[model samples]
Target: MSLEVLAVDDSRTMRDMIRFALEPAGFTVHTAEDGVHGTEVLDAIDPDVIITDINMPRMDGFGFIDAVRDRGQYKATPILVLTTEAAPEMKMRARNAGATGWIVKPFDPVKLVKALQMVAG
Candidate 1:
């Protein structure tokens, strides 16, 4: 089945890259600028998985995860943190905040697609 994804990041390039990586893989990709925008987009679509970056201008990934978890319908939605930060503590923090998985930045397109399929399935 094709998955619907929401990718939240501050960098335009990262969003475009996510779109490029997922779209041809048979996933429908939606993008947002930051946590606030991500929540706004979330209001409109119920994505199968949410991919967010750690650092952002308005609200960060942790906050975004919290917000997503608070929503009753989205509580079970898989949230994957995709960022350059690979600190152990950061991963734990994301886990505490309700993230389903984590991936380091400059991700391989094939691996990313595989990860998303693994998590969302």
Candidate 2:
């Protein structure tokens, strides 16, 4: 099945990487530079899942998750945190903000597709 994904991150390379990884897996990938941009993009598309980085300009992943959750339409959409930070506290914070899961950076493409499927499918 094809999944619609929104990936929010400040790094252009990271967005590209996510696109490369998911596109071949039959996923349609959308990208934004940061959380603020993510919300903007979200207005036009209904994503099956969202992936975000912790640190970003304007709004961070925590705020993004909270924002998405506050919108009733997206309250149950699975959000995955894709970031470099893997501290226990950080993961807890993401959970508190309503992230469905977390994946460390330098991710394996196959694993990411599997993860997206697990949550979004």
Residues 1-121 of candidate 2 have per-residue lDDT tens digits of 7889999999999999999999999999999999899999999999999999999999999999998999999989999999999899999999988999999998999999999999998
Q: Which clashing pairs does model 1 show?
A: none
Per-candidate clashes, comma-separated: 0, 0
Per-residue lDDT over 29-90 for candidate 1, one digit per residue giving the tens place of the 0 to 100 score: 99999999999999999999999999998899999999999999998999999999999999
Q: List the residue pairs that clash in candidate 2.
A: none
What's the lDDT for residue 102 in model 2? 95
